[model samples]
Target: MTRRLLLSYLGLALLVLAGLEIPLGWIYARGETARFSQSVERDASMLAEVTEENIEEGKTAELPAVIGEYAAESGGRVIVVDRKGIVLADSGAGSAAGPATRPGTDLSREPDIAAALRNQTTVTTRTCTEGGEVLSATLPGSSGTTVRGALRLTYPMTTVTDRVHRVWLALALAGACVLAAVALVAFTLARWITRPLRTLERATTQLAAGHLANPPDATTGPPELRSLATSFTRTATRLQHLLKAQHAFAAEASHQLKTPLTALRLRLENFEPYLDPRAHASLDETIEEVERLGRMVQGLLALARLENTATTPEPVDLDAVVAERVAMWEPLAAEQYVALAVTGVPAGQVWAIPGALEQIIDNLLANALRVSPPGSTLTLARAPGTELHVIDQGPGMSPADRERAFDRFWRASDSHHDGTGLGLPIVRHLTHASGGEITLHAAPGGGLTARVRLRPAGPPPRRLARRPHTAAPSHGSTSATVPGERAGG
Candidate 1:
């Protein structure tokens, strides 16, 4: 997490640097170039005016000397060309008195001179084969309507290029230094964000391992992580309290229900033979009610154990698990004259507690069998990724009933038999403990379908020992009576 946060911060810093530096460098380059151009333009115009005024005053002899002085002071070159393209005077080169006269010299071949001849100003860059570099500017010199001459000036670009290079190097160095500094700051900030998250993670691991007393320090890290720590601490406290209360209730209730169940079983045993046929039928109903209560108490105890369980999960083949349960429950379904079916077993397995998994499946199947009609079908199947589903062709539960189905002691009023009502609740608790969940919906043939999704098992610690199928006993002793077979009775 700290590495991730640091990467994120550095990425943002690079973005900000790119956004700032590129455009700023371009703007600085343009501003410096423009200012240099303006200075050259001003000096070129001044030189041109000086030559023009001297020529009009009939002081042509002094023009070369005056232009040469200005060129030397400005660190540039100056040349005078007449309207007939004659190179009359030169500043850097010696007096043009030798090869100075020019006519048809084709001065128009030079871009800046041509522009100046056309009464427009021009600037250009050219490299000197000599140990120097220069930028040239040309401006027209006019007396009244007639063009008298062209004034050309050359400014050295070496100084400007050197300055630009220095500025760029400085900026690059500064950018590197800034990036290094920002990286350090980003690492610090990232550590600040991630340290508390690491603590929270360790706390979560401990909580999962059943060490629920200790909580993370909420005052550490950033605001969001700190808030999360506070929330986890509060949640752990509440959960611990609730679990203690539930365990106490389950233990107390189990103790209380034991006496009633024992007394009810004794009474039913005593009344089994003494009463007439009608009285015997009522006694059977009472005995069934008492057994249902006993089952509910057992379910409560199972749920209580789940609440306090600290056992780590292990790998189990869910297909074989569901298959075994189906086989065990088949006789019971047959006795009720319900068609029991199985489908969709995958070769995969799941990580779960074995007992919890079995109890969950049993409760789902038992509930479905209780509500379904005699000829109705019960389907047990495995879905994708180690999920088991138990479905029945019975009256589908309403939305409200489905929502409340997992609450302890929940029972539909339409149920025909006496039920413990804690079956679904225990199923839910055990499912959660095994890192899975169960959902119920209407089956295709107008019945309840309970779908269980589970986590796939990892590799096992050792090989499983093979056992005989009969070793896994069926739930009931009597053979199933088909629905039609009992119609004549």
Candidate 2:
């Protein structure tokens, strides 16, 4: 983290240095050059006027001395060029004697000379190999109608370039100093920004781990971070309240179920004397009812625990779980002469709470078998995505019965076997908790099919995409193979 922060600081510093220094250096260099060129142009124009005046007065002998003195003081070269481009006088080197080397050359071809001949002063700085190292400008003057000439002046640019370079160096150093200062400030501020965030992370982890003894300190960092700490404190307070309530409920529920179960067990012991068939049937009925009540109480306690416990999810194998449950219940189905059939039990996994998938299948099959007639088949099939269907050819319910099947303690008819009516309710709750669903549908062959869709524990098998189906016979139907196909009562 520190390395990243330092790198970020250096990046910002370089950007600031470039932004402040590069353009400033370029402008300084251009301005200094422009000023030096303009100065040379002004001096050249003044010299042109002085030369024309001296020549017209026929004081040509004084011209060279005057021009030379001006040129020396100005630190530049001055030359008078005649109409034919002949160097008539050289201020820095005295008069040009005999035929000048550039005699009879066309002055019109030169940009400054062309402008001067048009009676306008032209100022420009140019590099020339022959004219020595100088910045030069030109202006035209006329001593008479026959003597038109140009006054050209040149000043060396080395001094100006040196000053510009010095200014550039100063700017770059100042920019570097400023960048260093900015980087220090930014580093300190970034640390301040992330410090509160780190504290908040630790606090949140503690909260998730059930550390409820002390709340996070509210007085830390900026206003936003302090506000976040306050929110965590409030949320922790609420969780503590909820947990207390859940504990109380579990304790109370456990105590309440104990009395009924003890009384029922004692009552059963008193009914052992009857050896007649009627007395045996009565004992069986009472025992079944008591057992159903016990199961209901157990389910209620389990559901309460499931509600209160913090459920950390893990992968579960739906198909294997379903098959295991079916194998366990196979003996019961066989004793009743009811055919138990299972299909599409793939060797795959799903994501659910452990034991939830088994419980769901058990409830579904139990309900189907209770209503089914003897010799009928109980079918179970698993589809893609951890989908399980327990279809039974039992006495199917109307639409109203289907809707209220999951309601707690609901019963469609009491003429059938005694049940706690909590089976479907528990099934629904467990399914929801496991992030799955349960739906009741009419089977294709006219029985009830309980479809259980669970979250896949692993990726689906990459094979044939055929849809799986399982069919079973109806319970209490006319074509029953078993003799005692009595409706469960």
Candidate 2 lands at a TM-score of 0.59
lDDT of 1 by residue, 1-489 (tens): 788777887788788877888788778887887888888889888878877777677677887788778756666677787765566567764321122334235565667776787788888777655646566778887765667778887767865877777778887888888889988998888878787887888778777655555578787687888999999988888877886787888768886887889897997879778888878878877787787667656555555555554555577777777777788888888999998888884747786665666666666777677667888888887677777778877777887778777765666666555665666666666566667778877788587778888877765433221110112324631111111100010
Which prediction has the highest lDDT against the true structure? 1
Q: Could you tally the backbone clashes for each prediction? A: 5, 5
Candidate 2 regions exceeding 4 Å error are 1-30, 39-80, 84-103, 109-111, 114-120, 124-136, 141-148, 151-219, 264-293, 307-320, 335-337, 349-354, 373-375, 394-442, 446-489
Which ranges in model 1 have alpha carbons more than 4 Å from their true place? Answer: 1-85, 88-151, 156-159, 197-214, 218-235, 263-288, 311-313, 343-348, 372-377, 381-400, 432-437, 444-446, 453-489
Q: After superposition, how far is residue 122 of candidate 2 from its true place, in Å?
A: 2.5
User: Against the true structure, whose TM-score is highest?
Assistant: 1
Error of 1 at 130 (Å): 17
Q: What's the TM-score of every candidate structure?
A: 0.63, 0.59
lDDT of 2 by residue, 1-489 (tens): 545777788887888678868988999899998888877777777888887777667665676788779856665667676555555666654212112224244556677776666566777656665543457678887644444667777666675988998998899788878877877887787767566666667667766544455566677666887798788779888887887687668647865976878698777857677456668787877777776666566555655555555443357766566667777778778877888777874837765665566666666777777777888998988777678888888767667778877776677763366666666776677677666788888888778888888776555332111111111223221110111111220
